[model samples]
Target chain A: MGQATEDRGTVHTVGLGKRYGSFWALRNCEIVIPRGGVCALVGPNGAGKTTLLKLLTGLNRPTEGSATVLGQTPKQESDYLAEIGYLAQEVPMYKQMTAAQHLELGAHMNKQWDGQLAVKRLTGLGVPLDKPVGKLSGGQRAQVGLAMALAKKPKLLLLDEPVAALDPLARVEFLTSLAEAAADAAGELTVIMSSHLLSDLERVCDFVVILAAGKTQLSDEIDHVLKTHRILIGPRTAETANPAYTVIKASHAASQTDLLVRLNDVQFRSAPWHVREPDIEEIVLAYMGQTKTEGGVQ
Target chain B: MNWAMWQQHKKQWMIFGGLIAAFAVFAVPTGMHFWHVYQQALAGCAAAADCDQLADQLFRHGHDANIFDITKFAVLFMPALLGIFFGLALVGREYNDGTNLLAWTQGVSRRRWLSVKIGWTVAITALGAGIIAALSTWWWRAGNALYLSKFQPLDFAVQGILPVALTIFAVVAAIALGAWLKRTLLALGILVVILLVVQISVPTYLRPHYAAPRVYTEQLVVQGNKNRDHRPDQAPVPAHTGAIWVNYSAVVDSDGTALNWVNPPEECSYTIEEASTRIHNEERSGGTPDVYIDREGGPAVHFRCLKEKGYHWEVRYQSADRYWKFQIIESVLYLALSVPFVAATYWLVLRRDA
Candidate 1:
């Protein structure tokens, strides 16, 4: 991926950290994502994914170093906030308020709120405007929350485990809606979503950022990551020693060994081995496991 | 934004508006009827020497007595209720329900949201309280001379600018507490307790200390048969009238030792018994007697003895003319005290986690 630039990047953080009573929830999290990049933040539970998202959205303030989302400090200025849309984990809404009323409130509260877009999306999805939000199904509520976020027409959209509570069908529908929105925007809207379901992300995201134990393990264009990481299955000691590939993970079975390695480019190096491109899920799992072995579980 | 906010909270606003409007409907007419009765009674007693007696008659036979009683009762506790209902529900419920996350993530800044909410609350509270204060004050004016003085605790608490000031205080206090606590019911409970303490303590303890009372010392006198002690030998200090609030009344020795008749000395037994007898007889004849006795004899004899022994009377009082001044001072004080609480709430909200 290209380096983060003030005008080109939608989000960048430098040594960003968050602490609660001496317990660092997220620490030393440095990340850079270019504008209009569909980034997927993949991490295990307690991997600071939510913390990072909160910081980016200005829903939270970093306890450590600075972060710039849309080239402004989080939670500092209203103008910057206006350009970002954030959907929290719970999808909280006023139970007594109808969907139409919520839209009315959004139109009132936001200077750049797109009322027509919000109404069209809701009506198209068959979400009744007169029904109270409390009476809606779980999937409907999440869609409503997503609609609220998208209606802002933000420069960047942050979703924290948006589909974690959805059923299998609902999960697909949610992702489809998000992917459709990103497609419609056509390289103008930057969307960063955090999810444990790596497969779902693989279908939608072009950029991948892997985090574990409050630290970022890998962040790059998804194509670049896929091209650099490879899985080798071969004999335990039938390889030439070279400085080309860095071993990320390895497992030995009797006389055979399976090795996951990161390299500048995938190539054969005169070995009795089988090399295959590692999927995003395998790469993320290797990185998360690597952090645990390195004792980064603070 | 203002219009949308009004639409969102219109239900709560309507409830509050309905309640206040209903109260006005009941209170205004009753107050007018009270004024009518009060005027008639005053005019009827125009030829009489004592207008105080005629005023008392209005209190006894007034058609608005029940309504006045209910309205005063409402005023006494309405501050707490309003604070808990509007203040806690406005912000506290947002936290409780976690809608603050949705709200804060919107384009609106947290500070702007709070300022608008507080501004609306203050305006609505002021409107409701202003109407109640105007109607009640107008009604009380005609009968004030016969009823309790404006300096009295109940009278002072619900009049002029105090109701408005108190409404704001209640709401701000509730907001601060709600922000800190996060739970609506818990915050409301604490608000009620705090308001109760404020309502009772402000009048009973804080008010009396607002300004130093005037000290009046007069020579002891002996009245013959004017008091309950009809034996013609008992006398005591009389309370001051015409814009003076009596805080304390006592007969003292030259050394300023407060004399006690509730626990009279051994030497005062004969005088006390004789005075008690005459007072009991007068009460049987449906007369209200002012009774006091000393160890020497009846009040007449005892006061003469007290003068011979170099005794006098002392009274501590607040002037009625300072009533408006005290009200203004108290309202300002309440509003000023609410500032830090409001600041603390804002700080907590700013620092709170999602």
Candidate 2:
């Protein structure tokens, strides 16, 4: 029901932009995501996804406008950062330290660190606590990094391509652990994970934010996006523009035209076209294709 | 967070601690022995006239010479190495390995994390260097009455609190440069080059001016080697006593005008090189070279002649009493110079992206 997806003031930003020299990595990005559930941050390579994550975590400050997480500015350290956790693309760790030592570091660094939870998570993954992180496999290291982040008991977790280095199976296992942790926390945890594997995201994410060319192309509940978009097959010369539907993308063959459109409470039976609900992949691809240059639909 | 960082960098601390232990092993017992020997050599000597001979015997036969010979170079570079190693380990490697991203994103603030690292590094470095300086200073003091003065460059840099100060100064410089470059090897390379230039230049050039050298003018004297046989021309007169540093010396006429040469009678005119060669030839041919130029009236008789003609000597020197003052002054200057680097490093770390 609507109560399940209702926002609890997770993240809010106003005209958030970050510029490096003359090039803007993320510009005028205005996005709000509800609390709870896994949020998919889908974007092509160099689509400013990592830039947005860095801004939210206070690793880098915004060049323009503001960004707030958990109803507090991200720049303030103790007030907001303690409630937020971040895992970067590299999954960096002290190579010389053991898995147990990383957890020890977490306990020492974080005031609210859950050492028992960290130990349980690592042991549950079958990762030996005494093995140095450098000697561990890539999958094991990623799990260690994830455990450390989760052990901080953060309200919001920001993961930037956390599973990019993992094999497909390992990716699933990692996401499964993340899902279990989220479920255990119930409504207390909100996750925003960026990934290129749209298929993997489809299974785990309930909300999606699609970014391209330094702009937000789409932001909505995944169920709503999947429910609102439909593929229409009709005549090659069909005039598709109307108040009931908005054309997101269109393609044509010799005798047929296929259009992906956003419906505004319109009945699909009134049109002289076959209507089918588009999957998340189809909707993401259609939206990404439309913004091949520097334009996107918010 | 600070404790975690310390644990992560414990290996680096071990290496630093090992260096300090090695220096202590080399210095402590040897220094105590030297101090004992020195006290014995000076005991009950009313005017300390025989102390020089006793000290010389100790230097030639005891461990003082060997130790001094080795530590002459050790004191110049140990502090610099400590600085470079600590700087690279503290911040440069973290940046290079991209671990700062992980470290900064933790619950701890970046500034707090960096402050803890810097604070611990500086404290350990200072403490280690302080111990080394104390041992070296004690050893130097034990023999200083009979041998080298604290005014010497090596002794000045290694004694008192200067070593610790210089070490801190180098570390601050290394941290700032590493923060700017974000590369460990590059920062270390530049740090070595900078420390080398600073280590060689400051003591050699800048230290002499710390206190104005006193000038003295007196009559020239004809002197000989320890055997008191051969008389040399243009020998400088001994001006100030004790371990004063002679900055400049020259032979002058009666009116205090500089003299290029002190000519003997024209009948025995010869350069000192010619006189020396002639004397060598005499020795080779089994002939007796005159033992006293003043008495025999050879070409070297010019020294005695100039003495008779009121030829004078002028010398510029820094007396030994100002050694401690200069050491304190240089240490203060080094500490003062390090402040800006520390400020710059903090500023850059706070503002840096990721």
Docking class of 1: medium
TM per candidate comes to: 0.86, 0.85
Looking at model 2, the pairs that clash are: none
Give the poorly placed runs of model 2, Cα more than 4 Å off: A1-8, A234-237, A240-243, A252-256, A268-273, A290-298, B32-67, B141-143, B222-241, B252-311
Residues A1-298 of candidate 2: C-alpha lDDT, one tens digit per residue: 1233234348777798999999999988988898887899988788899999999898898999887777777763655668888898879888989989888888888788898998999899899999889999888888888898899899999999988778888888899999998999997999999976466667889999888888888889998898888889999877888778888899888999898999986664546787877778878877767432232322
Worst 10 residues of 2 chain A by lDDT: A289-298
For model 1, the DockQ equals 0.57
Question: Ten consecutive residues with minimal summed lDDT in candidate 2 chain B?
Answer: B225-234
DockQ of 2: 0.57
Question: Which of the numbered candidates is closest to the native, going by highest TM-score?
Answer: 1
Residues B14-92, model 2: lDDT tens digits = 8878887888887788878777877776784536665435645766654558778678568768678877777755677
Report the CAPRI category for model 2.
medium
What stretches of model 1 exceed 4 Å from their correct place?
Answer: A1-4, A233-244, A247-259, A268-276, A290-298, B43-66, B218-244, B260-304, B351-353
Best by DockQ: 2
